[model samples]
Target: MDDDLHPDGAQDGREPRSGGANLLVFLALLPLDALVGGHAWLVVGMNGWAAAHNGEEATVPVTELVVSGGVPAAAGLALCWGRYWGAAVAQFALTAVLMAWLLSFQG
Candidate 1:
C-alpha cells in the first residue's frame, strides 16, 4: 500500500530556511511596526496630556492602533514563517485598515 501523504516525512528531505524567510518578512514589515510603535507612543503622550489638562479623554484611539497594527504584525509573521501564500494579502489588507484608521485620526 502506497500512502500519498505521510505525517513524519519532509517533502524533499530539506526543511525550508524558515529563519531566513522570516527574517525577510520581519525586515519588510519593520517600517510599519516602527510607525505603529511611534503612534502608540504618541497616543500615550496625548492621553497623558489630556489627563494633565483635564481635557476630554473620550474618543481617543485607545486600542484601535494596537489592534490594527499588532494583529497584522503577529499574524503575518506566523503566516510567513509557516509558508502561507496568503501572508502578503492579509498583511496588506490589515495595512489598509490601519492607514484608513490613521487618516480618520487626522480629521
Candidate 2:
C-alpha cells in the first residue's frame, strides 16, 4: 500500500522533512486565521460605515481588530518558513490566544 502510494519507493530510509511539516502547519493555520481576520475586518468596516452614515461613533476600534486579527494571520504566514517544532508550538499558542481573544467578546 505504501509502495502504491509512493510509486517510486521514495518513502524508505529517510526522515520526514521538517520543511514539509512546517508547510503543512502553515497551510492549515493560514486559512483559519484569514477567515477569522476577514470576518473581524468586515464587522469593523460595516460598523464604521454605518456610524459614518448615521453620524455616530464607531463601536469597535479599527486598531483593536487589526491587532487581534492581523497579528495571528501574519504569524501563521511566517510559520510557513519557520523551524518545524517551533512552528508547531507557535501554531498552538497562537490558536489559543486567538480563540481566547475571540471568546472575550461573547456575552
Among all candidates shown, the one with the greatest TM-score: 1
> Candidate 1 lDDT (Cα, whole model)?
0.59
Model 1 C-alpha lDDT per residue in residues 22-57, reported as the tens digit of each score: 457656766776677567657755765776588654
lDDT for each residue of candidate 2 in 1-107, tens digit (9 for 90 to 100): 77434766665544334766766776777777767666775676687788889997656654666566656656655654354555655665766675556445432
Number of the predicted model whose lDDT against the real structure is largest: 2
lDDT of residue 62 for candidate 1: 46
Cα lDDT for residue 78, model 2? 62
TM-score of every model versus the real structure: 0.46, 0.44
- Taken over the whole model, the C-alpha lDDT of each candidate is 0.59, 0.62
